[model samples]
Target: MSVLTPGDWGIEALWSALQPVWPGLSVELVDEIGSTNVELTDRLRRLAVVHAGGQVPDDAVLPVLLVARRQTSGRGRLGRPWLADPDSALTASLCLPIDRADWSGLSLAVGVALANALDATGQHLGLKWPNDLCLRDASQPLGRKAGGVLIEAVNVGHRRIAVIGFGLNVRHQTVPDRPTGALTEIWPEATPPATLARVMPALLQALQRFDQQGFAPFLPAYAPLDLLSGLPVATTDAQCPAGIARGVDTDGALRVQQGERMHRIVSGEVSVRAHATELPPAPGH
Candidate 1:
């Protein structure tokens, strides 16, 4: 499919795709197929902040969610673009009224809820810190990065609005040059978009709840899905390219035990470079 700009949002196609799946849910989708999820949300937030108390601009759509059928350049955290194919994923965003709240935390909460949704569908999904979903193949438990979440902050006066982006793999496919996987590979018969619709309500509800109670309420919710909690790992800043991830801190930074000191990395990509089968020979070797 060719890329679509926000101007090309054909409501009927967007509506047809989701109406059957997300019935009764208030989802206003735009047809911005070429937009990266992160950029799209940031644009929405900026518009809300810029035009506060004024009528919505002609080119602006506010307080509504955006879903792309063919997101040509959707991106994830650490500046990774989703290798989005029209039928393989759900590239979407949600808008919210942001105030003094660190509502960005909801991204993590949504990830956890999504894990629960996958579990409900008989899929065992694990969670990588910050907000990536993984699936472990018990026989070969080393897993794959299946999905990711992106959150951008938009200011509305003293208020901080947000546009949250999510990209999930629903088919048994992989992006040619990225470390991403899809649930359909694990569940051959599952409907990716339908699964998204089934799983999104809980995620939205959890986000709403967190907006009210803060991320504290979601700790228990996210704990079970923690994929590398105690596993020795290294975290790397996609930009700086160097980090050692020991574990997560109470505030969510990736902790790295380097000799006598431990470094907590709040932002970066953590890849499972060394799995069970690839252990070093011995201390002397």
Candidate 2:
């Protein structure tokens, strides 16, 4: 595969590479979008309406892969702005119907899949619980954030649709208020289209496996890449006291050891700073 330059992503190139891997998959490339996640969510809503009206087959799964060269208003977890240099980041969303009742740990599963795909290039990558991809090494105590996964679920009739969004920095760019890392820093040949080509198939396969087995099948795979294991951590939940990170349980909830008690945190922003020092409170406290 030839190395692609920055801003050189092409629909034809992406389709040619991904079509054989994912038969019948639909791909859309746009010059710019507010957010690929938002676009796919809207499309899924319209599809649900059409299905409800009996215009489309009920059992049909609408799988869409949308990629954007630039995102004007990309969003991360908790509605935080996901800013990246135009054409220098691989911003994409995958929307598909799944047959799972329990969606817990899907984000973690995605993180594992992404780490597996990128780590093949000889970069040691680690995952922060839930879904933050980081470049980790013995030299750097705190891992540098390289990418993230944001998942949103929409229920249509008895089926659930997932919109999984990915934002990976292909090149170094200024990310305000956070320490950022880029794939090109480790693999200088990395490019948006090439990175997407490597990651999308792995992600789709992982999602399918997760729908059938849930997060149980991914625990062992996630353990090695878990960056927060055996570390002091704090959470956005004010009532919850600081605790030692004990990895995730079978159900995907983060397990934090607070004194003699273990707390199963379902959802919150977790930080691995100092042992008892609280992180600056999130907006609205």
Candidate 3:
């Protein structure tokens, strides 16, 4: 494994490498923030307000990327806190304007894109429905979570901007009350910046495609990486019953087989373990 200092993950270095591929793309790197998602949301709101008032130029590009060395109030799905060591994780968020009226399956599409990108770097990552990246093992087929994605939308004028946030564990570190895994476990030489450079382009491409084609196009590619398929699982919601996981639908809903019927789960936290049992701690990232 190689050691990485904060100096190695410079914003200018990343921008220089990415500019050719993503021409005119804006990038910002901060030492610390409450949350990238929160920051981007606020920015989008201000942009929308300016655009609405016709005070902004018409030639401005739509997407902006923000990377943070540390997050004081990082968040995950269902309001979970995403905690990580400043040097051990890659935390980033992208604010992108979209034309889609229904953004139902964007999270699943982003997961597929990220999994493909990591695979290109010689790491086998799996998708745990909606938006979790997993490191699967034979004994723990559901896999230990290596990372996660959270997508939030803000309306800017008539456009909807999706704030896509991701947190990936790059090196080994202790995460209190969570079963976390790191990319270094597979790619020992991986660094936060190196991993980001590899994944960002793929993620951007996927988001663009998703804005045009929705989740249907990524269904086939996502199947091999789907970790919950054919497993008995339970939902976090008390009213939802436990069932056997049957993979996702075209719209990214989890299809769970309950008794003689198949039920579609559009949203909620799920676990492979029975509903009554306690779920293993998940990675804060």
Candidate 4:
């Protein structure tokens, strides 16, 4: 692994590329942090407190991209620990305001954006239902998870702030019982700085499109990349004990075929595991 310096991130270059997409965007890079998502959420919460006092300005909630060179206590969906070796992953969080009546498939939309951005040809990368980026190949069969997305939203006065956290393993690492995948498996030249630069613009654009059109625009793009499609799966929800994965619905819910009925597994409701083989535990339960 190449040693990454602070200059490798190219903060100004990224700002030049992404500033127009999101006005008042701020790009910040830290040497190390506990969790980018937690930090951003805490910042937003403080802003919210300020707003309650009528002292907050209108431009207070500007879009922010927080990058951590080394994240010590990173988190994944469902309150699981996402541990990554130093300089081995692209760990960051994006905070912005999203105005939508329904946020059902936002995470799926984000997944599609990241997958398409990182692997435009869709040959080596695909999405696991809800919010995981997995490797596409015959060796792993059902696709091995190489990255993931975790989103947390908070109501700030009249607006809503959504903090989207993402992690992509750039180099390979060995975890005791957790089988992991790395971007280098497909892109041998993958690096944290370059990888972040590759995906940020697409992610910003996707969020903008999602705010206007919702998850409908991303459904077709997500289909070809659905790793769990047509695979037998089991979930924690008793209502949908075991079934075959039949892709996702318009709202991004996991469509599971159980006997003669179809069950739409909503996000955050239950944990799902593909039964085609004894898959490793996902980033989150």
Candidate 5:
């Protein structure tokens, strides 16, 4: 693995681009960490303790952008391990105070914004329901996991702070059963720093919009990029065993058609798998 300094990431330029969307936002890059999400969440938890003393510092509530060049114990949805080689993936977390009453669809909004920012035309990138980012190509129409989002929040005093973490394969791999996609496939020259610069601004803006208007505005934008739409899916929830995905509702809950009943599967309720009756073909099979 090669070493990368803060200069390589252009912290100053990234901070400038993100400052307009989130004032007082700070950016920091580290050589290695356990997990960006865990780090940010822990920071807010510690800050919450300070708030109880009624002597919280001004910077305590300010937003921060933390990037890790390599993650030793990265995590995904359902506590799945997210493994990435040093300099082989882009892993970052953004922590900021959120004042929204209803936090539903926040992950979907982030997915839509990232998909648009990376591929505005929706040529090769697609979103899988709540939080997974997949690749769409002729070789694999069902799409493969390229990245994902994890949102966690903590209450500090009277304010709520959200830690939004994401990780994307840069020059990764495709195993026999678990296929993966990389940023290089879409952008031949993609690197961690470059990729972060491309998506951060749009992500920050989308978060702001979600905080104000909620997820209703992102419904239209999420339609075409939805990977589970019109596909037979199986879920872990006993209530909705199998159904054809009808896409997500206004609140970001997944709508599945089960017989004559349309069941709504909220995030964190169950894990979904595409093609319940048939498995997707492995790459080069």
Candidate 6:
């Protein structure tokens, strides 16, 4: 596969690309999202107003953008290391204003939003837990993970912005494995920037949809894409290690039946199955 001559993840580039699209979007350079949020929170403590929409108020929440060349230390749920080569991944943080009252695991809804955007790229994508978008192998019956989405909250004074990030493996499939390449074991082209570019519009649209209805609006679309639903599987959380996936809870948590008890799995290190096989495992493996 052909990899692009790696573009620098500079603040200027991010600002340049976003300024034309987001009206008043601004850019900030940082080593990592964690540090970026820290700095944002510090600035917010002083009470700064971000002018957005209409009628400028005391609370002006601007989107402090962070694009890393390569995150020396990146994190996912339960602090999993989100290590991806600088060029192989897309790591971006956009500070967006959100309501505090509805901050109960709202990331799942974002996953659904991202999934809807991925669907427009001509690839069948689905949502998987707290934050992940997976591409399914339709012929294999059960689908698998293809990419990931991560969201963080940065509360500064009266402004609370969600620091949303997406780590998408556009070209390289292994480690995260590409569904098409794994099935075919051969690539069709050098690289796919056109496909990757589709993410920008997807993200913008998803965020807008998320604030309106949370996951309730996307449940019908998200259900069929549920990979482990109705299947004997392992929960990402070891607390309920042995159980079958019952699907997601109303709040977007994974539901698994452990013996006679049904428990909602908020987190777990998931794996479809680790072995040498081209086909999905049997129903009750």
| Whole-model lDDT values for every prediction | 0.62, 0.81, 0.79, 0.84, 0.84, 0.55
Model 4 over residues 34-106: C-alpha lDDT tens digits? 9999999999998888788565555888889999988889999888887666788999999998988788899
Task: Please give, for residues 110-201, the per-residue lDDT of candidate 6 as tens digits.
Answer: 66655665465425665566576666666653555555666666555555668776555544545534352221212223122333344555
* Top-down lDDT ranking: 4, 5, 2, 3, 1, 6
The deviation in Å at residue 40 for candidate 2 is 0.7
| Shift of residue 253 alpha carbon in model 6, Å | 2.4
Residue 190 in candidate 4, Cα distance off native in Å: 1.2
Would you estimate the TM-scores of all the predictions? 0.72, 0.87, 0.87, 0.92, 0.91, 0.67
What is candidate 6's CA lDDT for residue 151?
A: 68
The candidate, 2 or 5, that scores higher on lDDT is 5
Cα distance off (Å), candidate 4, residue 270 = 6.8
Determine the backbone clash count of candidate 2. 0
Which pairs clash (backbone N, Cα, C closer than 3 Å) in model 5?
none
Residues 170-211, candidate 5, lDDT per residue (tens digit)? Answer: 877544578888888988888889989999999998999999
Candidate number with the higher TM-score (1 or 5): 5
Q: Which pairs clash (backbone N, Cα, C closer than 3 Å) in model 2?
A: none
lDDT of 2 by residue, 54-148 (tens): 54555466678988878999999999888655657889998787778899999999998998999964347888988899988575554888899
Tens digits of per-residue lDDT, candidate 1, 197-223, equal 556667666666777776666676666
Which digits, one per residue and each the tens of the lDDT, describe model 3 over residues 71-183?
88999998898865676888999877767777878899998888788875424788898889988777676677899999998876656678999999888778777676788
* TM-score (C-alpha, index-matched) for candidate 5: 0.91
